[model samples]
Structures are given as C-alpha cells and as structure tokens.
Target chain A: MAVREGLLALLDEGPRYGYQLKTEFEAATGGVWPLNVGQVYTTLDRLERDGLVEVRGGAEGAQSQKTYAITTDGVAALGAWWEAVPSDDPPPRDELMLKVLMAIERGDDHALKVVTNQRTVLLSLLQAKRRERRVMSDDSFASKLVTDALILRAEADLRWLDSCEEQLQTRLRAGGTTRPTRKADR
Target chain B: MTAHTLPAPNHAAVEFFDVVKRYGSGSTEVRALNGVSLRIEPGEFVAIMGPSGCGKSTLLHLAGGMEDPSAGRVYVAGRDVADMDVTDRAALRRREVGYVFQRLNLLASLTALENVSLPLELEGVGVRQARAEAREALAAVGLDHHLDRFPDDFSGGQQQRIAIARSIVGRRGVLLADEPTGSLDTATSDAVIELLAELPVRHGTAVVLVTHEPRFASWADRVVFLRDGRVVDDTARTVARSGLGAVS
Candidate 1:
C-alpha cells in the first residue's frame, strides 16, 4: 500500500513536515513499515501538485520547517478511502493453486510434489506468524492484526492442501496408479 | 534398534512414515492411526491436535515408544523404534523419550522431589545426582520451593508442573506429552505451554504435545491434525522465524 493515504490521514490530525509524517506513520503502524524520509517528501510533493495538501509555512529545510496540511479535497479523499469497500474482484492470484492446477492437467505425480512442498512451506509460515504475533502483540495492535490475519490465512491454506491431497488420492485410486497410502474410505 | 543422535534442527527426533496402528482383530478391528507421516526435530515443538479419539494420543504413544505400530516406522531421537526388540526399545525409551500424561501421575505418597527423581533413579542414576537434577528441573518450572510437598498437598497446576519437571529431569531428547495443560485454568495452561515451548530451545529436547485446544497448539512450531486415524492436516509456521516483522 502506498504511504499516500497514510500521510493524508496523519495530516487530517494536524500539519506536519516530511520527517514528522514519516515518524508518525511508523508509530501508527507499530514500526512495522518504516517509511523513508525521501519517499515521504516526494509523496508530499505529489500530494501538493494534486492539490490534496497545502504548504503551511514554506519549502524543504526552511528554518521554520514548512508543514503540510490536508486540503478540503484531501479530507473528502481520505473519507472516501475509508468508506470504500475493498474490492475482491481480481481475487488474489495464488501461485500455488496455479501450480497445482497445471500439475493436475498433466495427470502425473508432479501435483503431489507441488502439494507436499507448499504444505511444508506454508506450515512453517503459520508457526512463525503465530510466534511473531505472540511476541509483538504486547506493543502493537497493528502488527497483531496483520499477523493474526496471516496465521488464519495460512491455516486455511493447510486445509485447502488437505482437500487437494484427498482429490489427488481419489484420482489416483480411479486410475489404479498405486501409491503406498490406502484411500481413506470416509 | 540402534540408537544414534541425529543432528539438531536437521534430522527429526521423532518420525512416522505411513504409520498404522490397529487394535483388536477380525470384526472388532479399529485403526487408531492410519498412514500418518510426521517429523519433529530436536529443538522443535509440535502439537498433535484433534478431537477426542482422533488418534492424537495414539500418535503421542507412537512417538514416545509406549506402543507398537501395526505398520510402518516410528523413530525416536534418530532411533527407529519399529526395528527394536523389547529390550532395545525399552533402553531407547529410557535414554531418549519422556512422557507427560493428562493426569499428573506423581506418586501421591512421594514428595515433589521424590516424584520428579523417581524416573532418574529408576534409570539407575544415584539419588544425590537425581535429586539435584530434579531440583533444577523444578526450578525451571518455578516449583523448587515446593519440593518437600506431596502431590496431595499441591494444587492441580503445581502437580502438573511437578509432572513436567519429572518429564524433563533426564533431559530426554523427545518430550511426548498428552494434554499436558488440559487440567489447568487459562492462565495456568498458558504458563505450562510456555514452559513446554521453551524445552526445545532451553535443553534441546524436542516436544510432541497432544492438545485439542487451538490456542495451546498455537505455541508449537507446527500443529498436526488427525481425524478418524488419518492425518487430515499439518500446518506449520516455524517459531524460529526472526526479524522486524518479516511478514511486513
């Protein structure tokens, strides 16, 4: 996500320079996303060009340190962003699903390989996310929220994997291409 | 079976491959674990989670050498229990695995120190050395002060902690615990899980915890789910992942 909306949201509170915006953004996000001051300045310049913000004092490095304030239009934009229901249209392109689909089209063992490798990787990711959430949760609600979502999603992915494996095993049984595991009758 | 230590964080301290455990025969047969493949490395924590009779306890038994597999292999600390004779398996069990059950089965007549040291003493360690190690283990779980107290004198959580201290006193390579926190309150459960979670890191003892609770399982590096004797799901995200919000 761009730091644009984040800076605008900060300006909604009060006028602040690039450095202040950067620091505030870090603080708000639990220091998870550390914003570069140069990126902050460039974003501010764009916001100014777009008339979403106005200069309160002067320019960069001024003794008074010119602050940026949200314009009336910026307020409307921030409100719109907040009110906008996030689009799920594109439906996050999952690379593993694509790989599994392609492998199954070949009618071979590659699907099993893809499923097993990804399962291990995702399992490790879930463990790590849970541990991270436990550690950082005390100080940062932002990080806790993000990690919680990650852990939930990872768990769902593992269930999906079980589904995939079951389907493959069924297919294998129908074809009489034998593997060690007996098909679970249930 | 020959028992040799596998390299830490690489080889699995406990392993199962196409494992099947069946009870009874003809007409009354029950498959407790069907073709479950798993690996838990030294310094790792794994939770076997599922509803009751889903084979969670059976899996723990397989890992800890408390039972035999009807098919496939079970490895404990690099030693294949499947190939071992009874004596060899018993030797490997004593040297490599420690079990903590749902009930804190400390001898009611014995004090906390004696309860924790009995396993060591049974393994033929001198009473002095066993008691000293048991004391340290108790201290690790914040139970050193209660050493002279008997199980009857302690709360349920304290008894459980003493059970844990007993399990780890020998520093066995694999700690197989079945519902170790089931009897505790939420806070006590969290504290017990935290202690179990720390075992692998603190003493290089791998843990295979059997829990039906998702929250308790969250402390593990991986949670393996079983259903009707089959491994339905195994989810992992290693706890060892470090850095400034790596996901971010």
Candidate 2:
C-alpha cells in the first residue's frame, strides 16, 4: 500500500532513475520506510508491464541506465486507487492468541510467561517511537503528521496489552487454572 | 542388488525404477532417495510408511510427476513423466490425478463448493456446470449443508472432508494423499481413513497414501515400508494390529 502511494508522490516531483527514486523515497520517509533497491527495480518493471509507467531514452550507450516516468494512465489510476482506498485499520493477527490457545489446552504456567514477555516488548517499542517523534522537525507538516500517526498507533497497542494482561491474571486467579471452560473457546 | 523390469503398461498406474535424488554435491551431498523402485496398480489402495526423512513424501512427489527424479524415469499411467513437456504434464495432472495434502490447502475466502469447483474451473468448465458438479462432490462426502461455509469456519475434520471432496470431484484416475489424517484426532483420523478406503472401492480411483501412523496404514490393502530411500518391507495386513477392525 505504501509503495503504490510513494511511487505516485515521487512522480509528482519529477521523472527519475530506479536508484534515484529509491534514495529519494528513503529520505522522504526519514529513513524509516526501508525499501530494497532490487525491490524498487522489480516493482518499476511490473508497473511498466501494467502500462502505469513508461521508460524513456537512455544516455546513448549500452552502459546507460533508462529513465522511467509515470504515464497519464498511471496518474489517473493512482488517483482512483487513492480515492477508493479504505482506511488502514488492518485486522489483528496476534500470534499471542495461538500461544494462549495452546496454554489453555496444556493448562500450564506458560500463558503467564507469554503475556509478560509481550507486555515488555510492546512497552519498549512504544517508548522508542515516542522518543523518535520528539526529534522530528516541526517545520515539515507531512513528516510530523506521519510520525504522530505512528506514535498514536503504538500507544493504542500498549493500552491493548495492558487490558489483555489484566484479563488473563483475573481469569487465572478466579478459575484456579489458566484454562477457560470449553464453552468460551474461540 | 537386482534391477527390476518395468511393469506392463496396462497393469501399473505408476512405476519407478532405480530413482535417486541427492540434495547437494561432494561432502555436503544428502541422498534423499537412493535407487528406489516400485510399481502401483490401478484401483489398489497402497500406503507408504516410514520414519521421518525416509523419502516417502519424495516418492509420492515423483509418482505424481510434481518433481523430476535426479537419474531414473518415473512413469505415470504408462507415459514417461520426464519426457512430457510442462504444459502436457500439467494437463495430465489436472485431468488424471487428484491430490489431498496433509494441510487442507483450501482457499480461506472461498466456500466449500467453490473450492471443490476449482479443478473444473481450471479445465475451462463453465461456472454453472462446475458449481453443480462441485455440489455433487460435496454431497458424496456428506457435506451438502456446508456448501456455503468458508473453510475457516469449519472444524479440522470438516476441513479434511472438504479437501477430500475437492480431490475426488473430477473422478480422477489416481488419488495421491500425503498424510491426509495427520492433523485430526484419533477418532476423526479413523473416520477420514475409512472415507479414503471407501473412495477407491466406490470410484475405482487408485489411492496411494504416505503416512507414519501404523493405525492409518491398516486402512490400506497393502503397506510398503521404506528406510534410507529403499523399500524395506511390503505386507498385506488386513486388520490394525491394535484390534480396531474396519469401523462401520
């Protein structure tokens, strides 16, 4: 999703080589959106095949690199995709759920360990993202907006972790075991 | 070691001769299959059993023509698999063989009927006819009520049944099942094995299963044991040694 949007925004700036586009992309994201140079070239090749982009003449020798620019259809398609795109609330794919399910099957202390470790990791990541946001320039509104969104997501994740831990502890104490009754099984 | 002659074309559905598959070169070479040879008859329920890394799964892949043998020839229904081009081999697989993987391999988003209809759809069958045939296949497996349910909503046993329906939907000549009962509980596994046993008898589809469980092997008409890439034992054991007869 980010790749498609970033390519469209870069074309708005001007035409560029594969390597030049990759460098500019990394800089624009403050070096956070790490994209491989090979991936960039591969995606450009696909976009060309899809007729969303076109390659222009090279410097005039076999060793010269071809320059790529977005086609008119590319701009129109990208604009359509952006307008129809749903808000980015990705579904939860929690690996912890699998661990919790297994722990309930085994009826052991493993569930406590898994929840504790997840809490620690989520808290540390939230702190790191907050510190990173503090150092961003206030002058660039776009950069500040992206950073703020990322930090907000991290904060939400941290709160979720807290609630999960509390619920697990309460169940453990009340039931005298970690396993929930089969009726409540997911 | 004596070299065995290939079975007559009409007598065998699959034949393998002195096949060897090695992973790496020189000191790093790992021989996954070493001079293995076997033949499977049409309409026979055969099970290949061995300890882990004994190349049982490799043998199945070779028989199904999904992978090439490093040295020897693999024949499926009298045709040399190695000689067929990719397009022809793919056509043969689609038209003649059905595969049931240990993992259900159902597309999570599609309903049961849609998953069963995939092979026919790939063969250019129109959607209406393909869906009708898929419904018939699901009915054969007693899953008519589940035609509209997504795979994610079903239990493990039901998912396995849906996979079986998908495999046998076309009435393909050969059914290659790689540990079809691996993920189910004992009772469910027994039920699945019974269903697989009934398939060959009812549909005349040759069934070759790769499994490690002794109980599962009991369901086959014949069991061939493998060790270190060679067939070590072949037996006709009608009943499970543990005293569980064919479940009604």
Candidate 3:
C-alpha cells in the first residue's frame, strides 16, 4: 500500500534505475517488505501517469535501462505522506477478539480453552521474535523497530488473555453459570 | 528405594523421579505434587508455568532440597537428597544450589559486596577470596560499580540484580528462581529476565524459573506447564540460544 510513496521517496534521493530502486527499497525497509521488478515497474508506471515521477529518456517498458526522477508533484506527495498519521477512528476488527466473543457464546469453559490455545501460539511467536531481536546488530534500527512493535503487540494480547482467564475463573467460582466447568483437557 | 539402592549418577543438574508431596493424611490430605518426574540438564534453562495451586513452587522447593517428597527421590547434582543429612543438605545448598525468591533477602545493613560474599564466607571460603569472587559475580550482573552500596541505597531493579549476584556468587551449579520479577515494572522486569537468560551460558548454571508471565517464560529454552500437580505440557524451543550471543 505504501509502495507508491516509497518509490517516490527513493527517487527523491536522485534519479535511480529500476534495479537500483528495488535494491535500495529492500535495504531501506530491512528486507522485510520485498518488491519484485514487476511490482516496481507497475508502481513506477502509475507514478509517471500521475506526474509523481518522470522517466529520463529511453522506452517506457524498458525499466532497467531507463532512469526515473521525482517530479515537483512527487515532492509534494512525499511531503504529504510524511505528515500523514495512520487513523484508527473506528476500532480495527481483531480476529483474536472476535474468536473470544464467539467462544463466550458457546460457554465460559469453551472460551477459556480458546484463550489458552491462543496464548500458547502467541507465546511461541513472541519467543521467536525475541530470539530474532537478540541477534540484530546495534545499528539495525529498522529491523529493531519492527520487531519491538510485534513483541509489544503479542505481550498486550497475552495480558488480555490473562484477564479473560481471570474473569472466567471468578465467574466459575461464584457459580454464575449452570454448566459444569470441565477439567482442563490440556 | 533406600539411599544405598539408588541408581547410578547421571549428568542431570537436578532430577525428580516419581516425586509426590502431600500435606496431612487420608481424607484431610492435599496432594501438592502427584507422581511428577522431571530432569534439568547442565546449563539448561527451563521455565515452569501453571495456574495457582498447580505445584510450580513445590517443584522448585524439591529441586533445592528445601522439602522432602512423600514418594520418589529428589536428586541434586546426581545424588539422592534423601541420602544426605541436614549438614550435608546445608552444604549442598551452599555449594550446588542457589535460590532467588520474590522477596529479595538482602540484609539491610550489608553492602552488596558483603551480601554476595556472605554465603561463600559462611561456607568457610577465606574473606578476601570470597570478596574477589563476589566482585566478579556482581560484575557479571552489571553492578560492579555499586558494590559498596547497601540494598536500601539501590533502586528495585538494582536490588534485584544484587540478589541475583548473591545467588550465583559461589559458582553454584543450579539456580532456582521463583517469581524473581514479581514486583518490578515491565522494563525492569525485562532487564531482570534478560540477565537470567544469560546465567546458563555465563556461569554454567542450570536455571529453573517459576513464572506466571508468559512474556518472561518466552525467554526460556523450555516451558513446562503444570496442572493439578501433574505436568500437562512441556514445550522446548526449536533451537537452544545462549544469552551471551544476544544484544546487550
């Protein structure tokens, strides 16, 4: 989704050929978001059509041989992109929360099971992310930033699961439901 | 089995064989651990997790020779704990096992250096020798500059680091930590955990941690899940990683 602005931003550094843009983009993003030559040329064509980029001679489809430079419009668009903040006006739909809600309808015991199962999966993911973070170099800010974001999100979800388990247990102890709480099937 | 009939020694740092611990007798009895068997190898980092009353603490107590089991033998450093007398057990604890509970037991009057060297001093190591080893242990936990400071002089995180330094000071073979980060905030908790993750490699000590926080448990090489006194699941990481190799 940000590929168009990414390409324009790359061009802002000066004119770059198709292959050069692809390698620089991957390097800039820590190689997490990969771009094939086809996707790069497609985005470049759109940018040229919108006047965000200009080809420096040669044929249009001959991307590798042709260089691209950001236009005045491209600079303005890139500035806007830099200033834009991601919006969360409406709460994003989360699959974990949705599954918990559906599980609650089935029963507390079922919901507890779902929470436990999800917790294990998230823990494993967090472990792997931490290991990956451990090996990263001190200067790999891009990778570190992305990895930290992911680790924090997983930790937050695990905390939510803990609360869910606590509430379920509290209700069970108070005899709030008629159904018997089954023994843990773990 | 009698101590004389014990099996041949193996390389496990600690092992619990069909161990059971119960309180009271008959109808009034409550089983804290039920036929649980586990082994922790040298330099292995294991995290024990479970709901309340799931025997996590009991498992730790047995590993440290702090309690006796009703059934099966508990071995530390390949010797049956039941075979040891009280003095031998005390020496075993002083030499082979170290514990860090939620309550940091640093004496208020002692400096960090003294607190770390006290155990060694008690075990009859020369005062100067104990102090030298204490300095190295404190340095391992990043508190070398503050060794002369009393526990009251340090922040919660620094105090925890001191407690950890005390645990590993004498080249103990096993470190049993029970909720060591229970009182710290998230960032401090992470620092404490990261220090713990390094123990196996830095000191060649096997670590057994009991924690309710999955985030902390994720740092371990293996996670053992206990339920109703029995092990429900034991998950090991796909690869074993040492803390020394991680970013500081």
In angstroms, the error of model 3 at B35 is: 4.2
| lDDT by residue (tens digit), candidate 2, A73-127 | 8898788877875655676566756766576465535555554454434334443
TM of each candidate vs. truth? 0.62, 0.52, 0.79
- The whole-model lDDT of each prediction reads 0.79, 0.74, 0.86
Query: Which numbered prediction scores highest in TM-score against the true structure?
Result: 3
Tell me the TM-score of model 1. Answer: 0.62
What CA root-mean-square deviation does each model show from the true structure? 8.0, 26.5, 5.4
Which residue runs of candidate 2 sit more than 4 Å off their true CA positions? A1-186, B1-11, B236-248
lDDT of 1 by residue, A18-105 (tens): 7889888998886668988888888988999999999987665662387899999999999998998889967977887888877775
**How are the candidates ranked when ordered by DockQ, highest leading?**
3, 1, 2
Candidate 3 regions exceeding 4 Å error are: A59-61, A71-76, A88-118, A164-186, B1-9, B22-35, B70-72, B83-85, B124-129, B142-146, B185-188, B237-248
Q: Best candidate, lDDT-wise?
A: 3
What would the TM-score be for candidate 3 when compared with the true structure?
0.79
Model 3 over residues B39-101: C-alpha lDDT tens digits?
998898889987888899999999999899999999899889998999999998898999998
TM-score of the second chain in each model?
Answer: 0.88, 0.87, 0.91
Residue B119 accuracy (lDDT) in model 3: 97
Top DockQ prediction, candidate number: 3
On lDDT, the stronger of 2 and 3 is 3
Per-residue lDDT value at A124 in model 1: 57
